[model samples]
Every structure is written in C-alpha cells, then in structure tokens.
Target: MKALRVEKPNNISVVEIPKVRLEKDNEILIKVKAAGICGSDISIYSGQSPVATYPRILGHEVTGIVEEISKSVTKFKVGDHVIIKQTESCNNCYACKHGRDNVCVDLKVRGVNIDGGYCEYITVPETSAYKIPKDLDFKTAVLIEPFTIAFQACSRGRLQKDDTLLVYGAGALGATVIQVAKSFGCKIIAVDIEEEKLIQAKNLGATYAINGKSPTLKEEIQAASENYGPTICIDSVCNPKSFEFLVDIVGNAGRVVLMGFDTRVSEIPQFKITARELDIIGSRLQHDKFEKVIDLFARDIIQPKDMISHVFHFEDIEKAFDVIASKQFRKIVLTF
Candidate 1:
C-alpha cells in the first residue's frame, strides 16, 4: 500500500507501506477512493495541530469502498460505498455516558492521532463508517465530515430563522454557514479578509459579504443590520481577538460561536458580553448528525462541490501540501 506519512513537523513523504488489516472484530477495511486536504491537514504538516501524533498518516475527510467487514460488523458488508467518521472516543468514558462523545476522555483522530485515509486503504471501526448514496461521486462524499462540523456548530447556537447571523472567515466552513443560515431563512453577514472568498460567500447565499480589509466593514455590517447588530456571530477563524470583534458586532442578548482553531490568548470585551447577557459557545465536531449531512448531500440541499477548486494526485501529495500551506485554494481534493 502507498501512503502519505508525516514523520515530523515540516516533513512529509509518500512511501510504500504495509497495508492495514482490521485489528478488532468490530473493525472494517476500506479501499481509499478520494480524500480531501483540509485546513487542519496544513496545521498538522506545519506542526500546528495540537493533538497530532508523529509518524501518522494525515487525512480524515475521506470516502472509500468497503473491501472487508469483520464478522461482528452487521450494518455493512463487502463492496459498500462509505464515507468515514474520523472521531474516536472511549464509549465507556464519562463524557460518552453523558452523550458528549466529542469530548471523550480518550479521543483519537484519523490522520492525526491515528493512521488516516491518505493511503491506498485504511482499517477503521465499523461504528465510524456511514454508507453514502450509490450515485454520489467519491469526491463529494468526502465533504460530509466537515459539513457535519458546520451543522454541529450551527445547531449548538440554536440558529433561528428570526435572527440575524454574522460569520467570519470565507473558507469552506464560512461559505457553508452562509448557505446553512439561509436555509433557516436567517439573514447573514459574511466577513473575510479575502475579497474572492467574500464573493464566494455572496454567491453561496450570504445576504451581506464584508471584506474585513475594507475600512467600511463595521459600517457595512451595521448598515446591513438596519442600525442594529447581528443576533448571532460565528468566528470560523478562531482567532480570539477576531472573535472579540464578532462578539462586539452582535446585538444585546445575541449569541457568539467560535468555530475556528486559534491558539493565541487575547483580550476579549468581557464587560460587553456581561452587560448584554450574550451567550458564548465553543462547538466541537460532528455529533450524531453524520448521516444527516450525507442525506443533505444526497438530496442536493448543500452542494460542497462548488467549494472544490483544486485536485491533486497521489504522486503529487507534497505539491498538495505546498498549496495547502500557502493557503491558496478554497478546498483541495486528493485522488488515490
């Protein structure tokens, strides 16, 4: 089997490796079809993903075909087309007992803490596999994981049709939020430093797209809100200070969700939040909605293909990492 291996920070290589076999009776083997390069993949490559384990195979947004299923596996069998759920948690942990599996005590992730799908094949727990619509292409199926993340975040804030929403960053997640918010009939203001991304957000259904680089961003958001402010603000960039501005841009009693992965500590306007009775939430990844996102894709409700702007081959994995590190594309897909 050929796999892309990350041996250390700033080092990655494609090499022939031993194929993986199901080590558990509840496990299944999958033949990799297509895997998407995500922003976190770049972080892991540059040694920024905090929980990464070295000598790991780095790809989680994946779609594949089941080649073999363990005797104990019942929901799937040979030749089932599947998209993977990358989260790993101890089902007996305290969080799991409380139905908070995302914060499981012993969490492991594909392509970071464990071997992932950037290979010819991968062995995963049967619980992590979700069957996709047979008619859907592999490339589109890989997007379900991230789309589930977006859905989880939106749901945590209790997104409502009557509220105004502001989402920061125009990356794939940011763009998806715009479409999702619109689906609920919510007015959205999309913010980004990149003009192209803001344009993409608008095309995806953002009511107002503001380029943060523009001097008039605050004014524009205010104008779009009819002199009020957004009722819900989401920071997809995860920068604390950037999130502070998102918090500031919300109306009294509004909610703010931090969806980005910023590690820096910065000052936030605590006084404002305290006085306004606003809610601040930190959302994790896909919970139990993995199948729902697949249904959305199968039904053509949210087409993530529009965000797929780049594709890389197996032999060009390094080149793919280069482009990802440069932050040059909206989304990049890797074909095995």
Candidate 2:
C-alpha cells in the first residue's frame, strides 16, 4: 500500500505503508479512486489549520469503490461506488442526540484527525459512506463532499424561492453556493475581486457578478437586488472585510450565513445587528445533504464537471498542492 503523508508542517511525501483491513463489522474497506484537494488541505500543508495534526494523510473529499465489506454491512457491497462524509461524530453527544452531529462535541474529520483517503486504500465506518450511482465517474463523485458544504450553507440560510442571494466569494465553494442557490430559483449576486472568477460565477447561474474591488460594490448589489438589498447573504470568504460587508449588503431582517474558516477575531458592528435584527448564522460541515447533492448531480441541477478544472495522477501529489497554493484552478482532483 502507498499513501501521501504530511510528516509535519511544510513537509509532505508519498511513502509505502502497510495495507489496512476492515477490523470491525461496521467498517468497510475502500480502494481510493479519486480525492479532491481542498483549501483546508493547503492550510494544513502551510501550518495554518488549527485542527490538523502532523504525520496525517491529507484528503477528505473522497470517492472510492468498495473493495471489501464486513458481513454485518448490509447497506453496501464489494463493488459499490461511494463518497465519504469525512466527519464522524460521537452519536451520544448532546448535539448528535439532537440531529446536529455535524457540530458534535467529539467530531473527528477523517483527513484532519485521522488517516484519510490520500492513499491506495482506506477504511471508514459504513455510517459515514453514501452509495453513489455506478454511472457517476469517480472524478465527479469526489466533489460530493464539497458540494454538501454548499448545500448545508444554503440550508442554513433558509433561502426562499425567488429570494435574492449575495455570495461573498467566487471561488470553488462560492461557485457551488451560486449553483445551489440557482437550483432553488433564487437570484444570485456573486462578489469576488477576481474578474475571471466573477465570470465563472455568471456562467454558474449568478444573476449578477460583482467584483469585490469595484468602487461601487454596495451600489451594484443594491441595484441587483432591485434596491431592497439581497434577502440572504452567504459569506464564504469569512474574513473581517467580507463579514462586515455582508452585514452592510443584506436587507433589513436578512439572513447571513458564515461558511468560511478564519481564526482571527472579527470586529462586528453590534449596532447594525441590533438595529436590523439580522439573523447571523454559522454553518459547519455538511449535515444530511450528501444524498440531496447526489440527486442534484443526477438531475443535472448542479453540474460539477465544468467546475473541476484540473486533475493529477496520484504520484504527482506535491505538484497538485503547488497548483492549489497558486490558486490556478477552481477544483483539483487526484486520481489513483
């Protein structure tokens, strides 16, 4: 067996490792087929992620074929195609008991807290794996995890049909948000400083794509929303600037959902929140959205093929990291 290991911050290598087997009746062994490199993976590589542990395998957005299944695993078989949820929670926790396991007190994200699918083989609990249509390609299935994040964000926003949505970034996640919102019949306003990404957003069904660097960004958003301002604003950038701007762009009583990761303390405007009665919500990982995303893919409601701009062989894992660090592509996948 072989795996990509991050021995420490700023160090990663592909090394031969011992093969793993299903040791529990509730577990299934999968042969890794494709995995997506995420922004958090880049953070872990650069020593920027707080949750990442050293000497870890760095891949969570995974799609693989089942190589073996325990006798007790009746939900899956040896040849099934599946996507990994990555986030495994302790079902006994208060959050889990309330159907909020995504925020479980003892949440263990596969790639971050344990060995992930950055190798030839991996094993995961049957509960965390969802079967996908056998017709779906492995490269496309790899996107299910990231797409679920967007799905959960939109779910948190409680976006209504025909409502206007303002998205704070036009990167991969931002594009997903745009597509998901569009699927729900919401008019989308995508904001980003990169002109190319804004163009991509427009192609992804955003009604209006505003450059974050525009001198009249607020005015553009206002005009796009027909002067009432967007009813829902999702901050996928999660920086102080985007957070404050989200507060400013949303209409009165609008919902604001934060989906990006940032550790720095943000100075929020208490007055704006109090005066407008805005509903500020924080969305974590995907809840029960994987199946919906797969259905969306099947029905062509959200096409991810165009979003995947790059692919690399498993042996060129380091090169893939370099491309991700450079922000040269919308989505990058590693194929075994």
Candidate 3:
C-alpha cells in the first residue's frame, strides 16, 4: 500500500506503508481514485494548523470506490463509487438532531482527527460513505466535500433571491460560494488578489469580479452594487484586514460570513459590527446536505469542473501539495 504521510509539521512523504485494516464492523475500505488538496491541507502541511498527530494522512477532499464492506455495513457494497464526508457527526448529538451537525459535540473530522484519503485506500465509517452517481468522474466526486462547505456556508447565511452578495477570495471554496450565490439570483461580487481567480469568478457567473489589489476596489464594489454596496458579504480569506474592507462594503444591516483559516490573533471591528447591525457568522464544514449537493453537481446545476484547475498523479502528491501552497492554482486534484 502507498500513502502520503505527514510525519511532522512541514514534512510529508509518499511511500509504501502498511495497508489499513478494517477492524471495525461498521467501517468499509475504499480504494481512493482521486483526492483534492484543500486550503486547510496546506495549513497542515506547513506548521500553521496542527493535526491530531504526527505521521497522519492529511487529505479530506476524497472520492473513491468501495473495495470491501464490512458485514455490518448494509448501506454500501463492494465496487460502489462513493464520496466520503470530511467529518463524521455522531447522530445522537444535540446539533445533529437539530440539523446543524457540522458542530456536533462529538464530531470527528477525517485528515485531522483521523487518517484520510491521501492514499491508495482508506477505511471510513459507513455513515460517511455516500454513493455518488456512476457517471460522475472521480475528480468531480472528490469535489463534493469542499463544495459542501460552500453549500453549508450559504445555508447558514440564509441567502435570499435578488439580494446582492460579495465573496472575498476567489479560491476554490470562494468560487463555490460565488456560484451558489448566483443560483439564488443574488448579484455576485467576487474579490481576490489574483487576476486569474477573479477572471474565473466572472467566467463561472459572478455578476462582478474585482481584484482585491485593484486601486479602486471600494469604488468598484460600490459601482457594481448601484451605489448601495452588497448586503451580504462572505470573507473566505478570514483575515481581519479583509474583514475591515468587508465591513466598509456591506450595507447597513448586512451579513458577513467568515469561512477561512487564519491562526493568528487579529482584532475585529466590534464597534462597526454593533453599530452597523451586521450579522457576523463563522461557518465550518458540511452538515446533512451531502445528498442535495451531490445531486446539484450530478444535474449539471453547479459545475465543479470549472474550479478544478490542476490535476496531479498520485505519485506526484508532493508537487500537488506544493502547487496548492503556491496559491497559483485554483483546485488541484490528485488522481490515483
């Protein structure tokens, strides 16, 4: 068995390792076909975001086929194409009962709390395995986890039709936010430091895409919103400085959603948040909307393909991590 293991902070290797055994009756073994490196993965690769342990496999954006199913796993069978949820929620938790499972009290996240899919095979609980459409390619199936994050963000924001929205950072997650916002009929404003990402936002249906480095970003966002700026803004960059600009661009009583990973302590504009009556929300991973999000992709309603900018072979997992760290590409998928 070959797996990419992060032996320590800022260290990773793709080498032959002992195969994962299905010791639990409810778990199934999946032969990974493709996996995508997420922004969070970069944090784990570097020394920024700490993992649960050293020598862990750090990849959550996964798609694979079931190679073996435990006798207790009745929901899935061998040879079934599947997408694994990045996190597993205890169904008995209070949050899960109330439909907010992303914050389940006993949530266990793959790639962080447990081994993940940066390998030829992974063992996942039957509950986290979703049977994807047979026609869907491994690349697209691998995208469901990240896109589900975007979906959950929109769901938490309670987006409405015809409401103007702004998304900070045109990374893969940010691009997903743009597309979902557009589908709700809200005029989309996308902001990113990279020109290529901004261009991709427009190409994917954002009403307006602005480079955050542009000299007149404030003016551009204002102009795009017909003088009253966007009412709903999502800061996928998760920086205090970017949130400061977000506060400036949002209209009175607007909502701001924060979704990125920034470990450094930064000050928030608490005064502005209270004075402007803004709703500031922090979103995490996916909830119970996996089935719906996957259906959306299968129906061609949301094109995940547009966000996948680079594909790397399984052996070149290091290069894939490097590319993701470079921030020069949108979404990088590793095919086995």
Q: Give me the candidate number with maximum lDDT.
A: 2
lDDT of 2 by residue, 68-142 (tens): 998799889989999988788889989999988999999988779887889999899899899999999999888
Model 1, residue 79: what's the lDDT?
A: 91
Per-residue accuracy of model 3 over 1-336 as CA lDDT, tens digit each:
998888888888887989888989999999999998877777777767753666678789899999998889999988999999888788897899998777888877778777788999899889888999999999978888877888788877778886788888987678888877776787898999989888889988888888888899899999999988888888888877877778777988888888866667666758888888989888888777689788888878788776688999978876876776676787788898
User: Each model's C-alpha lDDT?
Assistant: 0.85, 0.89, 0.83
Give the range of the ten consecutive residues with the poorest summed lDDT in model 3: 46-55
Cα lDDT tens digits for candidate 1, 167-285: 88877788777766777788989889988888888888888888888888888898998878988887887776787787778888888988766778767757988998999888887
TM-score of each: 0.93, 0.96, 0.89
Off by over 4 Å in 3: 214-216, 263-271, 321-328
| Model 3 C-alpha RMSD to native | 2.5
Q: Name the runs in model 2 displaced over 4 angstroms.
A: none
Kindly provide the TM-score of model 2 when superposed on the true structure, using C-alpha atoms: 0.96
Query: What lDDT is obtained when candidate 3 is compared to the true structure?
Result: 0.83
Which model, 1 or 3, shows the larger lDDT?
Answer: 1
